[model samples]
Target: MKPAILFSFTIFISAFLLFFVQPLAGRMLLPTFGGSAIVWNASMMFFQALLLLGYIYAHFSIKRLGAKNQSKLHIALMIAAAVFLPLSIAPEAPQWDASPALFVIQTLLVSIGLPFFVLSASAPMLQSWYFSSDAPDAEDPYWLYVASNIGSLLALLTYPFLIEPFLSINEQKWVWTGGYALLVLSVFGASFFVKKAPAAEVTATAQTSSSWAERGLWTLLAFVPSSALLGYTAHITTDISAIPLFWVVPLALYMLSFVIVFARRQWIPSSVWVWLAFAALVPSAYAILLALLEPVGLLLGIQLFSLFTLSVAFHAILVDRKPSASNLTDFYVWMSVGGMLGGVFNTLVAPAIFDRMYELPITLALAFLLLSMHLPRPKFEPPSVSIGKAVRAKGMQTAFSVLVLATAAVGFVTYMQSVDEVFEFTNTMLLIGILTPFALWFVHPILAGFAAATVCMVLPMGYQHQNILMQMRSPYAIHEVREFSSSVGQFHSLYHGRIQHGVQATHPELSRLPLSYYHTSSPIGEVMAIREDFYDVTPVAVLGLGIGTMATYVRPGMEMTFFEIDPQIEKIARDAEYFTYLERCGEQCKVVLGDARLSLQEQPKGKYGLLVLDAYSSDAVPVHLLSKEAIELYMSLLRPGGYMLFHVSNRYVNVRQIVVNTAAELGYVSYFQDHWPRETKLEELMVNSSEWVMVGRNKKDLELQIFDPRWEEQEPDGRPAWTDDWANLWVYMAW
Candidate 1:
């Protein structure tokens, strides 16, 4: 076989394994961290840091060692890395009460760190080896980078579509191990070809000098896009489930940018990208403005397209400034450094410093600034009598700045005065605010970009500040206790991201009533009513403790246990200031703090007469709780005739089918109802739609009139039952 073919094949295999392992490992760890989007973000940070280290290792090995020595050392390291394969999280995983972000990083390092580091280092290392060889394609070995990203793109696309739907986590692990063995052989073969080539010759014309400014520019170009990737991924996943399908789409586009920009012929022209960058800012701003109000599909499409255009435009500039082969590793090392900085800021710094998602707008502005630097400066006449032109430009810049600030100020004041009304007008002001940056581009792009970002940051925050009574960020999610007032009365609500988890009336008499989706007419209400009728004193277990709203149904002498993952949530529920459900129940309600699945495992079997699964209503469902293993665990905790109720309502995922199929696999009789409150009094009561599925061992136990005629027995769909081994969220995505 030809050396070029062998080298390209090796690079492809390494790239495929590197990306495939990322999502697979994230899936395995999802349940441990309550299926938080932060899990993926933190994991991305770890991988980026490792990639930087790998580049450093490659740089030192090639520059410091002879070809024969480099080959022997790398081959030995590859074999060493294989020892840690068949990857899985460590046995002593962090408890939910502990620091989840720190533990996620720890777990990834121990389980897949060595293998990933070796794979990451191989691309640059092998490419350097190929360049030193006398292969016909050696002069332009960078084409191999395009091959590597193709493999990366294919791996990311295939995981959610093909591998995840078909294989279990354990199965994926073994397959990956086998692939690593093949990569090792391929690397060894490529090294043999390199060893057989003519001795290395040093090029006297190799460019070795690069200014600090050039390096800084490379870093900035890499930084903005990497930050934008995480910001957009988090934005989408927080609205939908934190599944591989959503995580991979933006990343695949990111990898495609590298492939497109670094190609022999650019896919999109430089001039086109500049205009595309400017055009994208409007929709990007619009998307941010309407993020909470717009449909998830439309918002995601706008942000993703904006991400692609901006990334391509900036990365093309990076490619244009690429140095000769002699400085290949140096260029990549700095690029990786920039990428790592972005990850650090997004994953580690932003969440701590900002209350909201400020990273998105900030990164977008930086993209504009970077692109503007590369754009041809608009020619201006000398200061000589052309002070007129300069004066006009300054005037326009000041006017545009005033326009942006005024728009933000008015939008904030409007939202504050009529927080419940003026949705259309506020959205309009925001759209105008985002577009205001484009007008400043002709005067100065940097100033324009900053003004645009300032508008994006301040406007939404004004509304959020007026509505939110208290806000807290956890490793799992951002939690807010909010208040709203209407003609009916004042209402207090709990929100996880944009999803309303629970609501309560502020009127002392009405505070005890279960509001929102838990209204007396909702499916959960019906289930609780049936339980009350059947048993004199029902012992209940609730999976989620959203302000302890379900405690309203517990009569005196009836015992209830609540499992809450986030400590802040538990604190809020127990606080009398937020809601009185838990406080009202007093000793009758007990809260267990930790992951429900693990916490429940420690409890005695068949203790609870009723089990309510309310954990699915948050930003992302804790998928482990919906798996066959989890269902069986819940069944074990319930008495033979006890009911297991799952709240499967979601904006993006249709979890109804998953519940029905899993129930069938367990041989449990399952019934489902889509309950919507009567519209006659909905506005006055603030009732919302809910879907609940009830499962039990004895069919006769569930035969009650409270189960409305509309409630039907759930039937199986053709999709495979979700198990601890395999589950595909794409099968259920509403889009």
Candidate 2:
């Protein structure tokens, strides 16, 4: 094969493995963690940081060892990395050792670390080698990146729709291993065709060294999009299920940006990208701020388009600022540095700085702010028309000033009025629309962008409805407390990822009452009531403590061990200001903080008579906690004839069949209730809809009289059980 084809083929395979392994490995590890959205964040951080390290290694390797020897050395390293492959977690790896984030990073490093480091290094390393080669076009190897990102985009796009649906995790691992072997062979074979220039001569032939300022710009440009990728993906998987598909989409778009910008044709003029980014970013910022992220089509379309456009816009700018082939390694080093830092910011810093999903707006603003410095000055006007141009510009500036103030004034008006009465007027888009037109009118990219961001940021300050009382964000998920008042009285409700977790009445008489999905007549409620005698005598283990709502069921003598993944949830629940379920549980509530599955394993076997899986809300259900293996683990923890209750209340996924099927196939009796309450007392209680499943060894264990007629016996379905090996969530998703 020709050198181009030979090099491209090798780069493509390496890139494919690099991208493909991310979701596959994440999916493999999902069951180990609680499927918290943070897994994706932590995993992204690991990948980006590793990729950055790989780039630095490649840069220094080429500079020190020369291109030819570096490739020869890399071939040996790739072979060594293969020994760690056919990737599966080592059994001895500690689960939740120290911290879950540290565990994920450590586990990933040991499982696929060396291979991934070598593979991730390939794009830059190979590109540098290609630049050194004697091929006719070797002088410029930047186009090879298009090939790399194309392979990356291919892996991302296909993983969910093709690979994930068909292959079991073990099978996927083996396939990836096979692919890695092929990549090693391909790279080794390509060495014959790729002849690098002498190290001294190659260095002398290339362009001048880039200054720190240029490198800093490169880092900033790369940083915004890298951060945006994680920020957007985090928002997606947090609100939607943390399934691989949602993760794949944003990442695929992210890869596509690299492909577009690196391709020979600048798909569009860089000058125009600023305008296009503005159009995309503003609407997206509006949706995120107003909490209008419906799982349905249009809003998602807007947000996704924004993610793609911003990534492309910022990356195109980065590409345009690239130095010659000599600085190629240095260029990529800075870029990956920015990318790594972006992951760090999203995964670490933003959680501490903001208490809501401000990622979309923050990233959008940063992109524009970074781009503003690079905006090309309009071609100098002829002296003859300079006066006319000056007047026109001033008029536009005046218009920009008036429109901005008007937008701010309108927001102030909304803030001044009774929020209940004027809530509809507080649309984020409407206020942005007022100023956006002036931004289009001869405005400087920096000033207009900052003004737009300012308006958007302030507009949300007046973004009040009658209900929501407080919002807090953690790396795992966003927790919201909303207040609702009616003819009867007032109640404060807690929500995570927009799904109501628990609620408590402010009224002193009704404050202790369970509401929403945990209503007394509800399935989990019925389980708590019917099995109270057993539970009071036997300790109860709650897998998910959503604002500690299930803590209400713990009797004075009964020990309820609440296994919660997020400390934020415990904080809100324990605080008297929120729902106060844990506060109400008082000494009866014992909280075990970590992944519920891992935490549950540390508990004494057969100590609990009742296992309540109240973790599933309408949003962000952790599938691992419901698998066949998970069920067995739960059963082992329960005393003989103990019951496991699942709160499978979800708006998007139909989790019943999978959960019930897996349980029944395990030789367990299962019953379920679709407890969607239609009738309730008007003045006192609010019972939101819920779904529940109960499983135990015998029907008698789950068929207690306290379980009203709402519960029905679950008949077995011949469908395959969802094991940790092969759980295809797409088959069960209602979407």
Which candidate should be chosen as best, given lDDT against the real structure? 1
**Model 1 lDDT tens row, 21-124:** 98888777765554444566668778888899999998777777745578889999999988897888875646546766678888899888999998998777
- The local lDDT score (0 to 100) that residue 299 gets in candidate 2 is 68
Off by over 4 Å in 1: 30-45, 88-110, 195-203, 209-213, 237-244, 267-272, 286-292, 295-298, 380-436, 453-470, 485-487, 530-537, 703-711, 732-735
- TM-score of predicted structure 2: 0.91
Query: Model 1 — which ten-residue stretch has the worst lDDT?
Result: 194-203
Give a tens-digit lDDT track for model 2, residues 203-283. 556677799999998898888988888877876666544443577788888888888888877758876776677667776
User: What TM-score does each of the candidates earn?
Assistant: 0.88, 0.91
Give candidate 2 misplaced runs (Cα > 4 Å). Answer: 28-43, 93-104, 198-200, 203-205, 236-244, 293-296, 373-396, 403-407, 412-434, 440-443, 456-466, 531-537, 680-684, 705-709
